[model samples]
Target: MKKMIILFSALLVLSASGNQTKAEQKADVSNISSANINQTIEILSTSNADKSLVEKGVKHAANLWRASDGTEEEFTAFCKENFITDQAEKELVFEKISRNIEIITGHFNKITLDLLEPVHLNTFEQHPIDNAFGAYSVDSHWMNDFYQNKIAFIIALNFPAFSLGEKEANAKNWTRQEWAYARLGDYFTARVPAELLQEVGKMAANTDVYIMDYNIYVGHLTDAKGNRFFPEDKVLLSHWNLRDELKANYANKNDGLEKQKMIYQVMQRIISQEIPEKVINKGDVEWDPYTNMVYQNGKTIDATPEPNERYQQILNNFHANKAMDAYYTDQNTFIKRQYDGAKEISAEATEKIFTDFMRSEETVKVGKLIQKRLGRKLQPFDIWYDGFKARSGMDESKLDAQTRELYPNAAALEANLPNLLVKLGYDEERAQWLGDHIAVDPARGSGHAWGGAAKGQKAHLRTRIGAKGMDYKGYNIAVHEFGHNVEQTISLYDVDNFVMNGVPNTAFTEALAFIFQKRDMLLLGITDDSPQKDALKKLDLFWSAYEIMGVSVLDIRMWKWLYANPEADAAQLRDATMQIAKEVWNEFYAPVYGVKDQTILAIYSHMLNSPLYLSNYAFGNVIEFQLEEQLKGKSFPAEVDRIFKQGRLTPNQWMVEATGNDLSAQPLLKAAKEALEELK
Candidate 1:
């Protein structure tokens, strides 16, 4: 996941209104007063130039210039000295700034990659120096330096920053260069201290490390009857691997439901800080999650529960983020920065979309269908029921065997990228090019795709590959991450402007990942020609969306609670999180699942480490479904290249260009209703 602090500066100050809190009402940090703005504009308008353009340039420069930058005289002189009157001259300056920023940022990205190697990669055990290096942001000082050198002032003078509302309203008329200029304005809008950014990075890195190494020896888990359901030496990482393991058991005939129940219990213990500290990442003892007891050599032993370490990490992340909130005068809270700034969509809008979809009749319809398939009452853990997938009935062991043989290591998977792409409709040459641009690595945690910031630098795809080999679960995650690499490679190397080198937000890239994940079976040469396959796919998407939307709601509510209760301790935060999860579950999920007060929705690791990222998965499903509809009759690879090449337009604009429709849950919901009828 991208560091939240890196994108924290991309905010425009919102106007104060009645609904805002007192703290939020004070968000504006513009250095220029209304009188000063008028003075600067009048002085610049006297020059023989377009009065409108001169006024805009002067006001923009005034907004960014502080007393520390200069006195009012210097601000006026700076605007008069730097504002470009000629259109051709302005375009030339824009190009120069874009090219130079690309060069600077590219090198900075490379430097960070090298410095973070020991921390991110599994090359060696992390040392104290590694932690410090990983926390250090090479580009943290760039903003301060640019402002001090007057480069930032020059850009602000020429390319005025646009509010999120302004961009949404007028983006249709903007040229690509205009969009690039708007992005440039976003670069220095916030003046957070470099030291604060470094601290945020360090806190995030520490949390990442803590989560990455959090493993549970499933084989050491025993039930009340003293029977181990998992294989010997089977280790699963918290929450991702554990959850995936629970889903995988739907195909197991012997003790599938029981295994899932046990995993669910383990998740509860972890979320509540009831899991024993010594048993974590250690295979030396057996434990029963239900009784919260440990055993060695068939004898019960005492162990202390983990002392709120999980919640402490989350608190540390919050404090680090909270420290920088004051610097963001407009988008004061991290929620505002995430939504209005990074997501380019309002939190209220996102929450409405998620809740509307979850509460729709289509969700209820699909839940009934899942219940019918399972031939039993739904449990709280049924949120993860894997019955909708094509492989739900197949033997997971056989699939795992096939994957293990095909991908004996990360190198083997890397070598097969070309063939996988070819199967998805890329030509031999194009497939080779994409494969060349992506590097696969053995991940120490759940897999993630890290896109290259510069041309020619390979995007890293990191997934777990055990000593034995890559299993089906790892292979599946690798394919999903590969989609991110493809989008990253295309947007960076093929896009026309360096400023527009990525999608509008992480959600757009996540849409591509979901698309590739849906085609994992296709990549493995497994095809379904059944007429009901399309309907099943729609149902799968709908059901998965239903599940994650609740989790997203929990994430959103938890963050809001944290902000409201900033002085709350770890234990208090944990209690609040569980209560919020239960509230969300009761309101939107209980009716469908026939269960209430479920805390399963609160167990996502991203809640603790990444913060407010769960919404992207839900949004991604909506986009992926729309893109899938658009690609129905087109060449897969060709359509992918065409759509991703449009570059970082706003989410709505990007969706319109890619699918000829706006991003909406209605399309998926409509299809889901039709699928439910057809299936019935």
Candidate 2:
């Protein structure tokens, strides 16, 4: 999820063109026959008697279409072939599938041909088959992004979870009935990617068309060309999956005033647990609570933590880091004192300085003047380091032309990257290996990530470099993204999980990337051991933690408000969220004046699109601080490289195993504040 971004950033403020009129084609659904009902039941009842034979038996038994190749034509054909025109017959058939457990269960088992994997904790059983279901009738990008890769991804989900010792299967679980439910219970989606209301309105309004039978629908989203728009990485999906995350995360005053930790605890508990059941209405009995953690079933969570000592430490570290972060916010009166530098400048002057930076030009007064305007937005880094100064040692004041003009993109400048990574921590071999992977291209949309040969388990990874209008800041961003691409390329391709890959969480990967990004100064051969350079490093940590931590707060508070008043409209929700961020800004950064428009922070689309993800930014920085503390002089490259190689464990688990300390915010905050105090 390093490429994690919302489809709605510009929609918030900067309205860029995204008016996609969905390829105005409607889809239809089907009717279940008695043969269909009986066949579905048989498949669910059976097991892996003959893997190959079962495939032949499946189609012979029921008229099921393999969405294995979910193309627009295939999807459309699926809809039309199965669609029932007679309302009475359609209801009768759908009722049979819905009412009979065996029918639904059998169908679910059959659909496993498309999804259902071993390590994956999700299974969107019966999806609403429509124009959106990977249809490539009019487009071919679907071949690369969807059909071939999409089906491969589905199969990837089937990759068996790597268990430690045990190897045998059939001897464990109880019944086929249990397996049927287990297969369907793990994953979820709201049927279609479109708004639930929109889908419902369409379904109800149009009786002529059937978008396939609703009874066998598995909730999955697809784009016009029929590609899964979701992030491909499973670990990233596990941490911040939009649909799955928000469904359980809801907790506002109206529904419940549960704290985030409590909610997070519930979420953690159910990692392998069954779904929690809540009463739909006063008359309804409690639906069904999730069973319990697979790692710990039928026992009290307090009974005994799982046997993984390393993971326990990770949990401990997570708490410690969060506790330390809390301490930094509450520690002293220094936080109350204003930066007189900011107060010295007027709002107009501050805006002018900021505008100059935004316009990609030189600014003599960025530190004081810009800080006042940006306020909490301004971490200590914005104080002195200019993007222009960062890349080109020549002063921004002296360089009259743009940064690209001064430092042209040439074979000469390409080496600046390898030299940069080596300075940070990479060895000669690793640096050259990574440097060679560097690649550049004009990007579509706004952001970029590791693409080309550099993405996922393919020995050759092209470190995809996307450049947005040439500027010093853009160049710096390109470098930062480059570090991320390198880390991702190396980790995904070089690490063990080529078949089962990617970091268990985006945070750990981000920490590695940030480690590279933070080296911008040191990487460029600027070795100022002075208080300013030291201050710059410390400032970078503080600023990194500050930005992400603030985002976490916003996410936490918004979710709080959202669940509190389930009835609130979008306007009410937006307004209340704005107020929450403003107050948090005032508290965390009251010292910095001219900090109007705190609500701008609320503009971060991640708050709406990516639930509970921002905290990782702060969390990653804290981990980096601790990792850096241990690796300061003692074989940092070796230590960090080994740590990055262990991909599958949770962040906390990884940290505990690598470093003695639990995930605590103190190391980063303490080290940073100490550096700040020294500067004073």
Candidate 3:
């Protein structure tokens, strides 16, 4: 039987929304100092070693790899040398987490330390020729999905116990979180095995070709609303569709394209219909089934604030459909544009570039040409991850001692925000207005911003800072992250339950945050309208949207595949995902590079950590493009800031205020088309 969704993952987050009083619990730990913090923990977690020792002897013993050039087996042996039995077992994943801490210790504790080197994370372009077991490699997207599924599974499995409280409830019904978890878990468990099969089929084909419809399973099944997912009794389902001129294995041009468009249209229309309902009833879901265990639903899904129910429902419905429909409707146009313009760089030219880059004497660097061949890299797939360290214009060691200097944690960001805003080009008045309106605080945990957890009110802004340290290399992320905090702070603080929080949906928030983030360069002593204004804005927008649109495509397809299968197992899910990934890359991505069946995009961690978040990046950039028009040359409009201060307003209304327009693909496509068309 299906279980309840408990939102345990949500509760696991000790957010300000949590019932516990954080102020009483959170002492000024910075006073203890990062040096003391690191040393104290080392003494506790590891001991009897020189704290400052560069190489491991005692303290570093727990996570140490062999001093010699050891193989993976030898490294494990070295780990056993010093770690307590319990600690040693965790060396695999824990060590990676510790790497973050190790760098922090190196800083003595300051987030402002310059620890990370810039990195290039274009894994999507790399996996084509990688000899590592083809698409079946766990290092591919499948691995990321596994962890994500694991989390959902745990939530589904545990929520029943949580809601029961061992006393009140039946102790064996689906709670809200458990129910949601089971729904998502059911999707993943079924998908994993299905995807595995798909991967085997691709590997068996032997030719480096893509099966575009692989992520999509062709099956006869009724959708949630009881409509047939495929018109035929048997569905020709897969994630990839030949949009615009995106070529696929299917030979029929007209019939295939028409059929593909119909599938896309139905999805677009279904989402247009279902999403509104889901959003309205989101907080409310019925639950009754008890399997190994069960929980009960508490909040009614789709319930809205009484004052704004009607308008908000309209807004909710609009927001639900707008982001996906934009792409779904205009997918053909994007494909056509790329198809007509994609340079026919043959397989020979492509491979030659890959070879030339590899054969170069320099081994420390990896460029896009070489990077595209390897699957699995950390994500956001941006330029922040550069091979070489960023230009170290400042001293790293001294920065660590100055917590008060580098946005001293999140709370300090709000405290020091006015000065930073001034430095970043905001006027004194506007800067002060920000300080007055928003409450900045450290993230209870992780990378997201919106609706505060405190006081059950949408009238407060919470700026969460989760940066381990604001190192020079990581400052870009810091600024971008703060942009999210700032937007989330403003939008939520200014509004009540009527408008409450959130724009259209998550995407609107992302776009707004991005608007602030793209200003990072400007804030970093280079004002947006400075000497390079024209070129700077163009470069930023082009790259930002260019990167996110491709991501959005993958995200949209993933959900569809999940919805279609409804019962795929882990291996099948893996194969199905890989096949879909290959197809999407080939159809949408390959032509541009004269490469086929590339699965580099599978490395996105969001594919595991947060479903559908990638789509928000694309939508956010589109919304940003439109908002940019309204914000142009305004010099920090107070009214604009006021609007932003109202957290979580619907995207369309925000657009109406910010740009006198509605949510449409026109702005996003216009920006993208204009930018790409002008590309050499």
Candidate 4:
């Protein structure tokens, strides 16, 4: 989901000042020394506090106390005064801080939601001014303000950030309040300057715009023999729609192979930056992706390939993230911050999980099964083979017709939200409450769930609706996004504390989304009567996890590559990306598909826009399968409500609490094995 804007606006703030380089942003040196830390700890030793916590907190505050913040003496005095030793008073202070931060973050989220409407929603024609406004961050300097006013030092001295290891080792014994305090500690762990944060925000906005408007008028595409394969008005956004279209053609009896080949060619051209510039987002020209040729009214014309803009965007994102490395001493690189700090899972462990799972014998078994079903040799695009789902056998045009009749526009979808909830076994009153809290909007791009930050603000569900109405693809994605909205609502509204009002990470939300997405047919009153339905579901989940895991590994390795070659230009980075994509594919995918040197794994749009996020979808599939198993023979709505309300526990902790098992791929692998046996 594109929920980053809410995060950016809520956590970071803007400074009303001039642009500053990285060195200039880090000009304020720490004034506190080891002597100051020792002195402060000694002064606080008389209080009945944990000595270990005191030492950690004092040292943490010392490191962040800048010369501009105060003198060493003043730092010592601030720690002495602000540090709470009494349990009752400390709890009271924590509660107050939680309330204040909720107010601050909630309002900032609202501001960003409003400012981004023109760009995010299909409300009007987008202008450069709209993008500028959308990119303007209001909270970029809020952290600086906090430090300047001594609030940051107060937080640091009280609730020092815990390492991921510490949290995992000790959190089982901690209370809910202590866990909330730990989350609070995470906020001030870094000190990125306002200007750098703003630049990051602008880059994020620019990439969002780029990814959103990247539409391909597939109807205008012509094959080498000048044959049209798609309808005249069918436009698709890359690479989501393109991939879906490829999947949809699996059920197509007429020209399905040719269409899949055409789409595959289009994807390769996009990844290699060989697509004609004039053909993108424009239907005035006919292009043959296989020949890399452009035509106007039956006349071939010379066309320049896109100038490595895709790779350039990735370079921009890398530089923007790399600029903050100096400030994050604890997690020096963006990779560390993303995995250890944000995801609360180490990158090493995540990679091993994916690679080990991808190498499993079940992968080859599943691939053989798919190939048997298709009665053809496996192609690179078969990675998205969709025949396992009930909907895969049905005509997509029929599903589109049904959806369009049901939901003619955003308003129609909004009106039917409560009913959709009720279909999932929610009672009328509860469904109304959820539907009331979620507001649907017309999306300019693929729909996403932008969750509400505060209780009063409504969560916005941006859904793409064609001029005719909501198509089947849009409805399916809408349901998936709806799952995110539901999780966002339950976690926020039912959690015990405001500080804990969310999932542990995006993966948890994605798990819920997958759960809802797989139920799209059920929601439409279409049930799979096959006795093999359960096994089919397992195989589907396994195949999907198998596909995305490779993509996620590629994403992680590419970031690592960029960090190693920080000075590489766009073309050089593109070459590196291509190399890494092939390496990953050959290692994990080639044995199954009997294909090598296929770079289709690199065709994911997330590689350019959402960094380090592909892993969540793979992990989410794992979580989704486990959760589905847990929900069997239980009250579906009750189980979902109860599990999600646990809210923001550490990943494994949350999994254990919800499913009586830790997060692992073993469950899925075993289930898929059993499924293969049954299907065979």
The most accurate candidate by TM-score is 4
TM-score ranking, high to low: 4, 1, 2, 3
What are the per-residue Cα lDDT tens digits for candidate 4 across 349-468? 999999999999999999999999999999999999999999988999999999999999999999999999999999999999999999999899887999988779888888789999
Residue pairs with clashing backbones, model 4: 12-139, 13-139, 13-140, 13-141, 14-139, 14-140, 14-141
The sequence of per-residue lDDT tens digits that candidate 3 reaches over residues 87-152 is: 334234333432432232223211111110010011124343432333232212332243343332
Over 4 Å off in model 2, which ranges? 4-394, 397-416, 423-429, 444-446, 451-469, 563-570, 591-597, 608-612
Q: Is candidate 1 or candidate 3 better by TM-score?
A: 1
Tens digits of per-residue lDDT, candidate 1, 1-680, equal 33321222322221111111322333336566788778888877877778865676676667667777887777877887897878899889988998888777777777877787777766568687887888676776777788889998898888777778988887789898888878777776666655555555577677878888899999989999899999979999988899889989888878998999999999999988999997899999999999998999888888999999888887776666666576665676778877888888889999999999888988777778788888888888888888777888888888888899999998999999999999988999999999999998888788888877767688888888988798988988998999998988898888888777788888888889999998888887788777899999999888888889889888888889888997889999989988998999999988888878888888889987787788888898898899999999999989999999887788898898888888899999999988988987
Backbone clashes, each candidate:
1, 40, 81, 7
Q: Considering lDDT, which of the candidate structures 1 and 3 is the better prediction for this target?
A: 1
Q: Which pairs of residues collide in model 1? A: 27-329
TM-score of each: 0.95, 0.45, 0.41, 0.98
Candidate 1, residue 102: how far the Cα is off, in Å = 1.1
Using alpha carbons, what is the TM-score of model 1?
0.95
Task: Rate residue 449 of model 1 by lDDT.
Answer: 88
Best by lDDT: 4
Reference-based lDDT, each prediction: 0.81, 0.36, 0.35, 0.87
